[model samples]
Target chain A: MPDNPQVVLKITDLVKSFDSTKVLKGINLTVGHREVTVIIGPSGCGKSTLLRCLNGLEPIDSGQIELNGQLITAPGTNWSAIRQKIGMVFQNYELFPHLNVIDNILLGPVKVQGRPRQEAIIDAQSWLDRVGLKDRALSFPRQLSGGQKQRVAIVRALCMSPQIMLFDEVTASLDPEMVREVLDVMLNLAKGGLTMLIVTHEMAFARAVADRIIFMDDGHIVETAQPEAFFNNPETERARRFLNIFQFQELERRRA
Target chain B: MFMKAAWLTVSLAFWGLILSLIIGFFCALVRFWRWPVVARLAGIYIELARNTPLMIQLFFLYYGLPRVGLLLEGRTCAIVGLAFLGGGYMAEAFRGGFSAISRSQIEAGLSIGLRRFQLLRYVIFPQAVAVALPAITATAIFLIKETSVFSIVALPDLMYVAKDLLKEGHNNESNLLLVLSYLLIILPVSLFFGRLEKRVRFAGFGD
Candidate 1:
């Protein structure tokens, strides 16, 4: 898979530790061009850590990460430039409260990337339109519902024209109904051939959207398979137990 | 003469506050960035400013410094003392505001490829200033009140005029006038800050 010409992101022997506690232990993963790889695991299992490491949010202890064939983990790497290529939507929306929906989206493009304001605004509007938030250009974050804020966050990332997008449980904070709207936007992105590395607890959404599924536990990649295969015929005992919790609860509900 | 004194008092307070804001913001940035050696120096300055009275600091600047041939004029000493005192409070206010910005916000800014300075400029500052506004306003009011002590340096301030009028044996009238002058200065300022705070809240900043 490393030799595949379509690979856009390559992580090799990736290790991360937090104050003497190892969070990621020598993990190797590859995500190809337009591939949607969804990482699923129980809480505290380094799923989020891996995404953080990829985005340069958290520093890696050892190993290397190559994005579009450039070694990103090397010292003196220009993260500001590299980060422009990697867009991330957070679980908490994290929209700038000071700016309106459109301003928030245009900030990175206009201010950071030094693009013209009018051009950036046009691009931002198109992104907002795609996410069904075109009318919310002037609305502030406090003025929007949780789902709308999350969608604005997605639009904010898209305006930068990132090569890859990272979704770190983007729908995790939304209300049940709100989750569907955010997930739908992501589903469209996945289907439209955006290279995405998603960490999610939405088992069904993960199965539906992921081209490949990665099951991680205790800082190790336990299993990697196609979504349907991983969901139906998990190889590891740990993954089986992990999936059974959701399945068993459904079974209990049916029996009742 | 009395009007001149009142103008001096307002002018001194205004300039002192401006100086303190610059000093405080710079020191807070140093401490926040944890720049070794210099951050320790900022910490020490904050402690010394916070612990000492403005009167003592003024006395040192006006009288004591002359002993070392580092003489400063009375008005200059008063302004320096006010800035020294006010800077510490402003720094703490700024630090509180900066900390209120969560890790995720910075991460979001970084993910958008913001440089560190850009992060501070775009994301961190606008919200932090909103959260720190009330405290900064309080500091401004306190700095204005501290202008009363500038009389000790014999710079013609509101309190200096009052004390001179007492020497002329017009006690109650002078005392009444002093109280009225302070009321005039403080009232409008308080009302203005209140309105500003409300506007920011209404505009939905700091949330």
Candidate 2:
């Protein structure tokens, strides 16, 4: 990596533990500008933990995490400076239930960026329209469907205009029928050249949109390849087994 | 005769309900924010007000706190007593609301770069209010009926006022006036809150 390369995020030897159990064991990852990296792993494999650490939602036991070449994982790192450039979307919608759709979208820009109210509102309305939720501007989170709530979450993050966006299984909590609509919005964002790091179980979508697909197990990167090479020719036995299990689960779900 | 007494019952309830709500909400906030020694002191006040009988609490405040150097009139003492008692319950109400909200909501706020104060104002507080609304409304009604305790304090509130008129005008005159006063005060209040509850439900205050 150069002193100031085009890479938007860099994680080197990131480690995290809880009591006696270690979750992320010396993982190295990097995300580049205008690129989408999808991480896939079985349950309890620390993929979500990695995503959480990137956003400072979970503290890393030891690691060096840098966003846009600025160190963010040190004990005395400037969080406000780093966080202002990153946006994250969680599995659950996590929308503020009390706020109307428009208020939820407008909150980040106005409060954090200290943008003038009128300017923030204009940006929020544009993002709301982008998510195809202009009509729901006055509606509350409870009034929307699971897919609608997730879309609102995306629009809310986009309202801040982050340089990097992180998605942690955003579709995991949605109804099966509702996943596609949410994914459609993500695909559009990716096409527009937004830099994103996604943790997803949807291999088909990952293959369709992700530039690089990384597979992990027990906190180590098992393999990193282009989506075609990783999905078609997994180099390791662990990757092969994990792919088989995911395929079997998808088959069972479809049959049922 | 029952109808006339019902009216008297209603009016006194109204005075109690409104006054307690104001007291309860602020006290709940004091407990929630954990203001240094104030939180523990609020806890002590709640225990004293709750463990003892309401009637006794009214008597103590109307007759007691004054001798200790705090002088308050009859009605003031009664209102203060109701507020003190209601505040204890309100603390629990607000705490329940606070715990009900998930951490993910706050995380979302932080992810968007909102500072601590901004997160609480824009996210946590609004959701907490929504979560606490049901318990708050129920407590409000409870406080209203509890106003009858003020009679023991000799406050000129609805119940005590009705009682005074009853004592002076004899059975026929006092009965009708008591009933009328209660019907005028309590019924309207209950009706108002009942409608508000439905609005909160229909408006979908809490998700």
Candidate 3:
């Protein structure tokens, strides 16, 4: 998999610790070009930690993460340059509050990438229109709904034209009705062949969108399988136990 | 004569506020960015200015400096004194605003590939300024009041004329005029800050 030219991200023995607690314990994974990889796990299971580490938000104890055939975990790696290629969407949809929708979307492309303002705006307008938010381009972040903000955030990341996108529970904070709009965007992106590494609790959405679903627990990936097989028949007892208790199915199992 | 004295007070407060804003903004930036040598220097300056009385600061600038052969005009001393005292408060107000920004905001800026300097220029600064405006307004008003100490340097400011009038027979009229003179000076400043605050708030900054 490491030798495969199609692979966009490769992680080997990724380990991360915070003050003494080992949040990510020696994990290995690879994501292929345009593949939608979804990570699902219980709270504090290091799913979020893994995504953060991948995006260079946290320092790892000892490991290697290669993106697009470059070893990014090496010291002296230009993280700012690397981050442009790896777009990330936080759960909170941390939009720039002072900026209007168009400004927030154009900030990276124009300022960081040094693209001309007119050119960046043209691209931003296209993405906003794609997200069904072109009319609200003049609105500030505070003026948008949670779902709208999340969509705008997605558009902002997409404007960067990143090699891969990392989503860390992008819909976790939204109301139930708002969740679908965000999930629908992710599904559309998946269909559009964008490489994505997502950490989510939305099992149904995960099953629907992921080309491969990774189940993690206790700071490790316990199982990796196709959605249909993993859902219908989990291989390990841990996977089976997790799949049982993860949702309303747990109560049904107990009742049966 | 009273109008001239009040004008003197207004000019001192106005120039002093300008100098202090410049000094305090740079000090706050130096401290907020944690620039190695300057951060410590700014910290010591803030502590010294805040702990000591403005009168002592004026006396040191006006009188003590002459002993060291560094003489300055009385008006210079007054303006410099107010700047020295008020700068510390403004730096603190700015720091308070910087701290109020969430860690996520910084992270979001970094995520967008903004360099450290660019992050400050684009993200941290505008938000911090917005958050700091109210505190800055209070500091400006306080500095205007601190101009009362300018008379200690014998600057012939409003307070000096008020004291000068005390020696004469016109006690009630002098004191009342002194009080009104201050009102005339401070009221416009207070109103100006109020207008500025409304402008920033309307533009949707700080919160």
Candidate 4:
């Protein structure tokens, strides 16, 4: 049976290499409508590479990425169209440091989506409130804290009305106290049923929100399982070892 | 006696700064375009103008260029010298501003489907101006001081009027009046520009 047109996104055998090293060997995944899938891995495990490749930020050596039933990596693909449908939030926040928060949110819809400025601004205002930064619309990125900046980044992506959102360790740069605020925004995003693919180190967030957890290691998908089963009874040795590190840290925190 | 020369100096400095800024803007754009030959040529010209004395540069434009059939009036030569000197330094200042902007910002602009020129004008230029404003103000001050060199070209600038007043028996009083004249002109303009710079900066255009 063919997948639904609203299936959101699919990637098949995505391969990417940098110089002599292969960052993403081959990856395949599907994101369903209104589902949240979080990819978890150790550092340098190609999780971020996979997210970047899916969004066309990093060109894949070979693969088929389909968003809204449109082939994104096919020959002569309309990349602008692909990007407009798929939004990405980077770990570093990547909020245009020069633009005010409101301007940043409106930039994509007005400029790329060709919406009127007034319409875009109104939409941006609502999205800013949704992300909990309505009062910060006039502030510069440097003026905002890490959490606020991350919220603005999310709103910036959301304003594009992307059917699928990809986040590459979105809270990785936040302070311990600030991390929760940013993740709280992501939780709200999840509650809204945004189709999302997230590469994250935040295990609590993965367990709490992800419908599916994909564990990647050495440029390969080591395992894909529901968050509860994967955390409770991981099958792959790589997944076991990765979970061991986090579990040990959690145990130490509890003992303390 | 120094009042007339002070008026002349103020006018020359004001107009010379404007001319220099116009030339600087284009030179900065040419540098920003990163045309290898053109960029190198701009670099050479700036170095030549900056390393040499402003007075000598003014004299060369006023007197020496005439020998090669490129004669211009003394005042015109002064403006040319100031513009060339300003263009050279401002080009580098602009290049610095360009480098300071993050690559992601440019990519973000492109991802939004902004054409190359639109990207530069709307995104690149506005942000670069915020970064370049300080250097621009500094260059303007340098250009103002440079207008004093026009006296060597026999232009009746402030310094020229002051010298003439002293020679015509106004003595120490001319020196005091000249100093006061410079204070009136440069102080207000610099303060106004400085305030404008702060406002633009406070408006929070960054990236």
Candidate 5:
């Protein structure tokens, strides 16, 4: 890691709960500019909840989240303004089915940001081309495959030019072959130095692209380390067990 | 006379539908916001309007309100009464539409920096309209039929004209014309809405 990379996102003792069940318990972390941080955890470990809290989609019970030194999670904060700096891609594509692909990409910039439609369309077209879906711009979401929908979703978020992007198991819902195409887009973004926080089960992709891997269990982060070290020599028993499950799956795949 | 009355009936149902849609939209928002007092109040309003008879509601508006120093013309009372009644059912249909939307869709809108109102207008409303279209069309058909109750208020609507014509000893012809007039007005309108419902059906995932 470069010395003293500028901190782009800061989280301090974040706590979130749904009624009596606590989901995130006092999480503390920071992401440097253009760094890729991947969060790996079992289901119901609050990984997705953490990403949701960053953008104020889920209100925090306590603690502060600062984006570019602006207090985002504070009461009376303008969440809409904060959201402009952050983008999120869900496990489900969540594309507006009524809209064609180009319209879906342009909706945020045109509707929310008040950009002129023609100008947004010009910009949105380039994003579509970048994802290799320029030909399908006028096609409705229902006309696309799972991979194509996820690609459009990523392009939609990118159209906002957000400073930080969050991916919540974005490929979890895709078919095995489709997952590769979606991961490729993320890989291309990582190479371009777009700051991202991802919650994913794809250990290999995490190892390949992550600057740091944060392992979460229950509601707490059990360990944070570089991907190479985390996979080869996990520090905590929880991390080891988590890796073993992946290792066993990998072994079964090889034998088959 | 019957032709004039049919036109009046159509006009009442049309205006009543517009008013009901507007009221139902806001009421659905109130429920969605989940504010304790207002949501409960909205809930009560829906229940009250839905459970009571439309004829009684019109009677209250036309006859009962004068006692409270709020008198409206018979025509206005019928329109308002039908609107109030239809709004209750429309609110439920809209609420169902709103609920059918996946939580992630709203989250996606929020994450993309859409303000609450913008999110509802652009992303949420379009998808919801698709989900709720059939219900709304059903409500429209019911409201059109419910306008017959306006005759009780002596609004000179189709049914009122039929009743007057029957009482004046023009019995068989008036009854046959009344039924045919209703079919003529309602069948086309219902068919139009049914086609519209099909047109707006969402083509997205999880439909």
Candidate 6:
């Protein structure tokens, strides 16, 4: 890790609730400019809700989120501008089924950013080539495989040149075989030093790529540590139990 | 005389459908936005149009309103009445289309920096049109049939001509001509809409 790393996102005492049920409770964290922070938790732990709040998709009850020193959670903030800096890829790969690969990638740039369509197309083609889907430029989402669709979704976000990207279980809805292809793209982006925050259940990928792992439970951050320390020597009982489930699953796979 | 009335009916149906679609689209948007006072007003309009019979609505506009100095020609009254009725049903159809869209789709649009109107235009409307086309076509057909009811208000539509011909001792010929004229007008229009529906049907992502 580099000394004096620039912090790109800072969260302080963030709280969110839905109908008296608190989802994210007093979360505090800072993400470095090029850090890959992976959040792991059980279902309903507010991992997705936290990511959603960062993008202003979900309103917060209290606290503030600062993106690159800008108050993103402030009242009446122009979220559209903030969102252009912070891109998100959902679990379901919400590609517009009506649009082809190139069109989907060009939508944000050409339509939202007012970039020249031809220029955006050329850029989008390069991104598709990088993902090895250049030939699929004209292919609609339904025509593509799950892995292909997810790759296009990543490129769609990348085309915007966002300062940070949030991926919420992007590979969760993919088939077992398709997961590796999407993970490879994420790994490539990580190697390229793109700032990312991911919520995922893939423990091996987390261990390999995460600069830090944040373990959450019951809408609270139970522990935050480097992957090596967190995996080998969990500091709390909750962390240990959570890791055990992964370990048990791994052992069962080995036996099988 | 029969041909003249048939042309009048066709023209009335065309104008009535155009007005209905425009009114319905905006009404649907109002409800979708869910503004407090305007949404309730739109709700009341839709309810009134849907619950009351078209004849009474026509009579109120053409006859009843004259007492309040809001007089309109018979043709204008008929078109306006039919449009109001069709708009209510069309609003529901468009609302159904809007509701069928997944929230994630809108989230994706917003996440990529699309403003509300841009999101509606590029992402939401295309998909909603796909879902709503069949219903809209059906409503158009209903609206065309509804124009026949305007004859009761002496608008000189096809039915009015047929009634006059029957009273002049040409009952069999007039009834046959009436049925054929309706079939001739409706069949081609229905087919055109059917083809439009097919062309716009979305090839949705795998189930």
- Each model's backbone clash number: 0, 4, 0, 4, 0, 0
Worst 10-residue lDDT window, candidate 5 chain B: B198-207
Q: For candidate 2, what is the lDDT?
A: 0.79
DockQ, candidate 5, comes to: 0.67
Give the TM-score of candidate 5 (chain A). 0.97
lDDT per residue as tens, model 3, A38-93: 99988999999998898788888999999989999999989999999999999999
In the range B1-207, model 5's lDDT, one tens digit per residue, is: 878999999999999999999888888888987988998999999999899999999989988999999989998998899889999999999999899888878888888888988888988888788888889989988999999889888888899989988899999999999889988988998899877777776454445
lDDT of 6 by residue, B1-207 (tens): 788999999999998888898889889988888988999999999999899999999989988999999989988998899899999989988988888789999999999999999999988988887888888989888888888888878889899999989999997899999999998999999999888777666454333
Question: Each model's TM-score?
Answer: 0.97, 0.85, 0.92, 0.85, 0.95, 0.97
Q: Give one digit per residue, the lDDT tens place, for model 3 in B112-138.
A: 888898899888887887788889989
Pairs in clash, predicted candidate 1? none
Q: Say which candidate scores most in DockQ.
A: 1
- Angstrom error of the Cα, residue B172, model 4: value is 1.4
lDDT of 5 by residue, A100-158 (tens): 88888888898888899999998988888888898998898888999999999999999
Model 2 Cα interface RMS deviation (Å): 2.1
- What is the Å distance of residue B183 in model 5 from its true position? 1.2
Interface RMSD of 6: 1.7
Per-residue alpha-carbon lDDT of candidate 1 for residues A124-182, written as tens digits (9 for 90 to 100) = 88888899988989998999999999999988888899999999999888888899999
- Residue A110 Cα positional deviation in candidate 5, in Å, after optimal superposition: 1.3
Model 5: pairs clashing at backbone N, Cα or C within 3 Å: none
- Candidates sorted by DockQ, descending order? 1, 6, 5, 3, 2, 4
TM-score for chain A in each prediction:
0.96, 0.96, 0.95, 0.94, 0.97, 0.97
